[model samples]
Target: MRKILVVGAGQSGLQLALGLQAHGYEVTLMSNRTADEIRYGRVMSTQCMFHTALQHERDLGLNFWESQAPRMAGIGVSVSGPGAERLVDWVGRLDGYAQSVDQRVKMAGWLDTFAQRGGQLVIHGAAVSDLDYFARVYDLVLVAAGKGELVSMFARDAARSPFTRPQRSLAAAYVHGLGPRPEHPDTEVARCNLVPGVGELLVTSTLTTSGRADLLFWEGVPGGPVDVFQGVTDPAEHLALTLDLMERFVPWEHARTSRVELTDAGGVLVGRYTPVVRQPVAHLPGGGLAFGVADVVVTNDPLTGQGANTASKCAAAYLRAILDHGDAEFDEAWMRRTFERFWAQTAGPATKWTNVMLGEPPEHVLTLIGAAGALPRVADRFANGFDDPADFENYFFEAEKTEAYLSEVAGG
Candidate 1:
């Protein structure tokens, strides 16, 4: 049996480790926090798994919260002007729904499940120097940790990375007492309110550490009005500041959150990171190589909410590559090839679409959004792109492609 060490317990690390174990591989999964700690710890991410990613989880028997998590049937986009007046508002329906399970809930449950499946679980922090020691024991080491000094092992790929700094100042909090969806009171949707030149606000129904609640996310343009949560630690205080920002920029959301309260004491998170793509092969001190996965290789701004979805796809792709290699040397060449396959199929398009959304959108892209407001097919296509970003390459990314597609829709 080939022994594999997977560091980090986020979506990629746990999913890949569990998949390899199920396939009868010798897998050791390491996490900084244990299952119990993760369950009761602060929230990690606003993780909404779209249809494709959800199917990947189901195939691996990892869809533990499907029945309990709130279902998001569509995406509602409200673009407002400086004065908080809505310029265009529409809800784009998706063929299949998406679901958000708080990482605190999802990751903790997954950690327990991984241990039950006969995989070795190590709970501790790992440093880059630690990789030098681990490189000698395991046949192959995969680094999935998105943060910490260990991540510095992978060098940034300047050619592929477009941004040198964070595109948005991000702040998120899980809260209870949010009012019903204004458009369809009974149904939940991923509501995004964009205030051009200022920032964006996203509100979605999600399963929290406690239970179902709303996730309020603010993405402020650097140095903008909504970029005010630098030192806020209390969840209640975070909610208060978030509510104030919403009231001034997105009144509709403010109305919904007027009576909102924190889901728990540790339900808030505030931070910022520059989106980047790093070289997949990291050279250890002892001249050994470790492969990067998920955010370790390709980190994108959460403006498009693609972080968790991308991580799921990366795990699935890497798992297939490992199974196909079948006792072959897991050398530096194989590591690069594996990441290349995943990058070509999944990561490339996702990064392009996310970067496009972050910057000022082109005229043709704006036109498509306007068309989607009136046409159900256009709206559905746009919303479904979140599930498979590769779909954007056909009609949404390039100016000429979008214009040509829109003309055909109009003619039809």
Candidate 2:
């Protein structure tokens, strides 16, 4: 059996490792923390898995929280002016529901399952030098660690990378006591409240360490008013500042979250990172090479909420490529081909859609959003784009295409 060494135990690494083990590959997975440590650790991300990504987990038999996690039926977008006046409000229903189970719960459960399935679980931080040693033993070494020193293994693809600095300062807190959506009282909706120049505030239902709760995520444009979480360590203090910022920029969300408090002391997290795309192949010292996957290669700003979904898709794509390669030697040519296949099929479209959302949205996009409010078909299509970003190429990405599509939708 082909032996594979996977560095990092995040969504991409664990999924690939577990899948390989199930397929009769000898898989060794390394994690910085054990299952219990991750279970009790600080919150990692605001991950919402759409239908396509969810299917990947189901195929691997890893959807452990499907029944308990809250179902996100649609997305509600509200744009506010400088004075906090709601300018445009629309709700777009998705064709299939999305779900967000806390990574702490999901990853911990997956780590345990990996061990149970006879996959080697090494609880240690894997470094570049360590990866070099592993490359000799394993047929293939894959780095899926989303952050830290392991990311530096890959060099940045400057030609494809768009930003040198972070687009937004991010702060998130998982909380309970959030009120229901005003439009759809019974259904849980992913709400995006955008303030054109300032930033965005997103509220979505998620399963936290304490069970189901709403995730209040803030993407503050650097140096803007909402970018005020520096030096804040306490979760309660972070929640207070978040509520204060919401009251100023998104009063409607503030009203719903006013009484909400952090689910635990470790429920809040604050940080910033540049959205970047790097070369998937990384050269290690001592003449070894390792392949980078998911966030390590293509990290996007979370404004579009595509991080976890993209990682899941990357794992699935890479898994397929590995399975198809059979007993072929995993040389540089094969590695490049494997990454190229995934880039063309999944990562490229996701990166484009995310970058478009981060930059100055064009007039056509604004018109499309406005049109979505009046047309349910338009709204449904727009909402489903999150599940399959490749669909954006048809109408959402280009100005001419979007205008023509909108005209056709209007029957004009």
TM-score of each: 0.98, 0.98
Counting clashing residue pairs in each candidate, in order, gives: 0, 0
Candidate 2: lDDT of 318? 90
Candidate 2: which pairs clash?
none
For residues 61-169, write the lDDT of model 1, one tens digit per residue: 9999999999999998889876898877888888889999998888999999988888899998998888899999999999999999888999999999989998999
- CA deviation > 4 Å runs, candidate 1: none
* Candidate 2 Cα errors over 4 Å, as ranges: none
The CA lDDT at 270 in model 1 is 92
